[model samples]
Target: MTEIGEVIELNRFDETSQVDDPDLARALARRKATFGASSVLFYDKPIHMASASGSWMQAADGTRYLDLYNNVPCIGHSHPAVAEAIGRQAAVLNTNTRYLVDIVHDYAERLLAEYPAGLDNVVLTCTGSESNDLALRMAEAFTGKRGVIVTDLAYHGNSASTTAISPGSRSDRSVPAHVRTVAPPEAFRSGDNDPGGSFAARVRGAIASLEAEGHGCAAIIVDTIFSSDGVYAGPPGLVDGAVAAVHEAGGLYIADEVQPGFARTGDAMWGFARHGAMPDMVTMGKPMGNGFPMSGVVSRPDVLTAFCEMHAGYFNTFGGNPLAAAAGLAVLDTIRSEGLLENARAAGKTMMEGLRAMQGSGSAIGDVRGAGCFLGVEISEPGSNRPDAAMARKVINGLKERGVLVGATGPHGNVLKIRPPLCFGEAEALVFFGAMEQVLAL
Candidate 1:
């Protein structure tokens, strides 16, 4: 077995364990066999995950990594509570929304209780993109407007409608005539101050641009934490003012909480809570089912009713099937009973402070920003904040070699996205930070 707390050398695994399991071997080989050689990003140290629990993942090669990118395992992978909940529901029955089930209503009621009062209605979908599509449809139906304002690097979903408004998505080769893009309230990029007013002004300018093009603004959709664009947890009330600008432009506001919802932020259960703003519609996903394929669009009852009246209907075969709902319920229960939110807050502070201290000391780190558990370290050239994605990739690869897995984001993919599961503890954070320091030094 690989030594605990020590990085596993790739040669060690290759020499010691020559598995004859055809199934696993075939599966691994298929990346090269079927999808060609370059399909995978084949890191120098790749973790063939075998098992996971709490904040750690054990690879097939018997190395343990302090996971910092697993938001899907919100309650921690293989949580006994969540497993039991899924088992109980699966053993009993797995059905659809057409059939009346008490668990469905119970889960909906429980989930809605987490949102603001008026935002009580929810429509289940299978992914954040679908949830966003549903939200867009509702916004358009309710207000008879089709124009949408989006942040410069905000990502929503992969669907066509979502891609239209997701400026961060590159597949949008053909820009939608009705969609407008605004700059995100990225304080770091906008010069280390509350960029709320400037960002809001950009929103108004976007609306003006759309109107100037004769496509009036209908809605403004924003990612609460701008996770894909590199966790920009804007200053309090920053997005509120942006929402106000959208509202003043006769447009609804949609908060895409796909990555930051379900209490990953630690400070608030949802990302909008950190912004201190009430969104007209909220799209959630990822941790909602704790790795199960499920997502949702939550909106005001009045807005939902308006869409309903307009004949807008949505139905996903397995969106909120009993199994997924059970998993979601278990996740929420685990969050409450285990105090993961508070854990996230404390651990986030420890990790962010560690990173901040490492900033000026190391020439690799440019800026460290984020809130709660969603932290990011912006990497740049020494003494120059000009984004250096090449060095960032080197840092990521170096960390991977050290047996620590982290992610990169930002437009240039230089911001290290430091979002571990909620169950991740300060101890794990300390280890990860140490690994980061070693990698930066290299």
Candidate 2:
């Protein structure tokens, strides 16, 4: 029997013993044998992808599907500039950070230029998980406290420490002793009149609980978009008061920008800026190098200094490699030259309005909310606000059959996550909207 409120992978593939397609059948068997129980794929029937470009993925069968489930490849799949940069650099060098690579310094300067004044120092990593892991260590070392607070449904990373603090990632609704959870600023679900105040109150309570347990509230980290907690992205300054509360208790605030950074939020380069909150440390990845495995942590000099003074020999081999640096430089150049930030604002406006308009089709769409290229459509029962996980599954499968890719998220796995590449335009947005309407009609 499944545990109650067990956080699960939505639309996880359960291998079928038989299938009509011989190639797919063989592929499934191979995956089962190689990856074993750890293997997970999306959709009822997974597609064997061959290539992808400009918000669309083509399968081995030559079927092109509009991709709405991608968070990586934010600039669009296999972007020419990024791919070229990686290919060109790989021919020359692939050395790690210990080497004094010119391109690496160039990339670091350009990336750090995107952040605000206070967060100046940078520690490069191979993935956002690693960046967050380092941030946790820094917080613990600086404050001499082990306590952390995150959203009830947040998913920061898959590392041991990150997983412990990620309440929703657990098989059951259990968190580690030093971790506390606060409700996200759910403007749509809760209908709270004072969302900022309510979020602040929750943070205050979590801090008190941590202190009572002798953890002393080292830090309160959050995905500025609250991506895993149903994509709460409204009522600007929603997290401002909560951040103030954390600061009042002398806890650092770490902004996990893996979801909402790199101009994906439309209004600002980072999600925390839109929320009117400044973070002590910012962890970023996902779209940093467009498709390269590059991530980093931006923090104040003093905080990083404190941590380094204590633990002098921390290093990651492939963290700031030359190829990643070249790719990062290319991604930065592409974003500016292609006008993606403005495109995100325009295309996102189209998507949000189109989705909100689609709500009139049926009561199954309980809510449509989010910012820029990242949005969530909450599925619910026809006559009530109760989440409809079954209907969500049906809708996701239906969209797949119609050559549109989307996924479900949230605590109940009923919130349809719509995060396409930043290059997605009006044409792509309309494609998804039309396909969604067709699915709902079915």
Candidate 3:
């Protein structure tokens, strides 16, 4: 059986699993040669995707798989509006931040409008890692502290600084000297009556520890949905206490909205809003440009001004280019015009209800929980709460074999992560539920 933290790592290919197909084998060999040791392919038999549409992806082998694993294309995969906007802008002008671009300003205004009142400044970046890296710098500069806090299994990003805070990247790795890890608000397993208070208490403890260690807390960065920590978005206000604790300790709250932003939660544009905690800074990516590479940090003007004054101005070569801004604008416009959020809420509710009903009969299912379109189903022992990563792996592979695409997450990697595009509707939900039912039944 695969250990909790090791489940995801076990999905990668090893020397034993050799493909019989000559084409796939050649492609795999070429990928390995080019990508080298860092190459991490999904599943034992990876799918060579040829194209993707609204809720489906076609493999090079001509197999169409329902996509339930992607949140990056919030509106939908290959959205025509986004593609056209990018094309039009690229044809006209695709320059950096140095140039005066109306599209960049337009996107900034539109994106900033979605944030809370005080968070008016936007610093665009090319990826979530860069946004988070900037956020860490701002927090350290603003607080003059070197310490940061995160959930035990948190995954912020890939930069050197962010990697120190992202334990999910490698659970076997030791927590850095400047970072402290706290238990996530796991109401399901912890069974704490006051999950918010419990989480807050843990944050306070972590802050005290940091202070004692002479690295006073700088920020508590968290993925509001806790996507990497098993998708815990329940017990609204779970982070309220933690936010207060961080503020009280003169630390900032950096909401890593890379996974839950852009109405993926079906409740708000930002996940911090749903938790009722106002973050000092909100970092967003993934779905910002509907698959276009665009990310940003929305911060208080005062905080941003201080950071800018202290460390000079910040700029990214392709951060707020005309093409990116155009793509972002089209995504926002489509979200409103198509009512994707409402669809997510309705479809997600139906899907969750169906999963819960299945749980009543599925012995392997231990829990069903989530918010809006982001949901997680935990696979566990038949009569106990012990995580069954083996079962989870089986189910994930089974789903893939049955033409459904989903992934596993959580500290134990026993939770089925079902985060599809916001455009997923009743039809998609039905198909997903049917596939899930079949997989679980097996």
Candidate 4:
């Protein structure tokens, strides 16, 4: 038998650092041996884990690292309140959606109340991919159209239909069709002095192209905060014009809020609110169940009714199970009771301002953009706006070495995505900012 230990060198982690586990690699090897290797693996480097609590994750080597990458842990990892709720529900009941359940109704009512009065229809799912797939279905059923328009690098979900609408699908070695992609408002890549203006122009061009192709589109799916495409929360009302164009072309507006919803933006419960636009369909996930596998789509009642009338039966095995509902309810309750949204607003202000201030002092810091807690710091070459993915990776990896865990975003992976749990405090931001400054200095 091949010795697994000789294939990799193990690194020791500090008490507050992430630990690596050989077991994870062994498991990966087992998968490779049986099911073949993953075609979409980003890197070979893997961080194995033991457990997570609050804002820290422990690895096999007993290292505890501060977490800044996990947007799903909105109430914070292993939050006692949410855990207790899940445990209670699991012990009592875990029924399917076919049975009448109060938890589902209560969760739907509470979640719906957050949106504008007319967008009240809701459908629960197990992942963001499912939510987006449902949104696509609604668009097709309501408009009897098969075409979709998506942002150039927008990431909706990994399901077949959602993948058809995602640019990441291509990078993941998947082919897509029947989708029109528009350039998002990116100041760095578009070479326009005004990213917002450039974005609008690109959108107009996409609409024109789609119209010419006889695929005018049933809907244009947009990530309200554009998380995967480098986190550009556009200038207020910038996307509104594009949305108007789509509407005029007889298409619905779909907002994929999987990464930026549920008060992650600080000012609003949903990222669409920040864009100053009302979406025809809004898909959400990640923070909805506080790390539990639950997501949903909120649509105009008429659109959902159309889907219902056309589809015969749309059933998901564990879409809105009792346990998932309990988790969702707990997440909402914790967000309200803890004032986490307010916390996100205050802490996010500190993070954005601090990053902007850092930009003034260092040429390595290119641009800082986003709203509330959904911010991204773009690393670039000195005296140029060009993305410096290498330096960005160094920064992120260095922070991880120093016991702080963050993530990289953008098409080139040069943007530092700072979406920690909504419960993250200003003090924690200061710590992260300080750590960032130190890493950059190094």
Runs of candidate 4 with Cα error greater than 4 angstroms are 1-36, 39-45, 172-177, 188-194
User: Worst lDDT window (10 residues) for model 4?
Assistant: 1-10
TM-score, prediction 1:
0.90
Cα lDDT tens digits, model 1, 57-133, are 88776878777876788878888887888899999989888888778788898999998888989898889889999
lDDT score, candidate 3: 0.87
| Residues forming the 10-long window of minimal summed lDDT in candidate 3 | 1-10
lDDT of 4 by residue, 275-362 (tens): 7668999988888888899989898989999999999857788998888999999988988999988988887888888887777545
Q: Where is model 2 poorest over a 10-residue stretch in terms of lDDT?
A: 1-10
Instruction: After superposing candidate 1 on the true structure, give the runs of residues whose Cα lies further than 4 Å from its correct spot.
Output: 1-28, 32-45, 171-174
Please provide, for model 3 over 1-442, each residue's C-alpha lDDT reduced to its tens digit, 9 standing for 90 to 100.
4554585585666635869988888888898899988888887688888999999999999999999999998898999999999889888988899988898999999988887789989999999999999999999889999899999888888999888888888748457898999888887666678877888999999999999999999999989989988888877888999999999999999999999988888887778878888999999888999899999999988889889999997989999888999999999999899998888888778888888887654488888888888999988987677788888888888888989888988877888899988988788888777887888787
Provide backbone clash counts, one per model.
0, 0, 1, 1
CA error at residue 212 for candidate 4, angstroms: 2.4
RMSD in order of candidates:
6.1, 1.6, 1.2, 5.8
Candidate 2: where is the Cα deviation over 4 Å? 1-7
| Candidate 3 TM-score to native | 0.98
**How displaced is residue 265 in candidate 3, in Å?**
0.7
TM-score of each: 0.90, 0.97, 0.98, 0.90
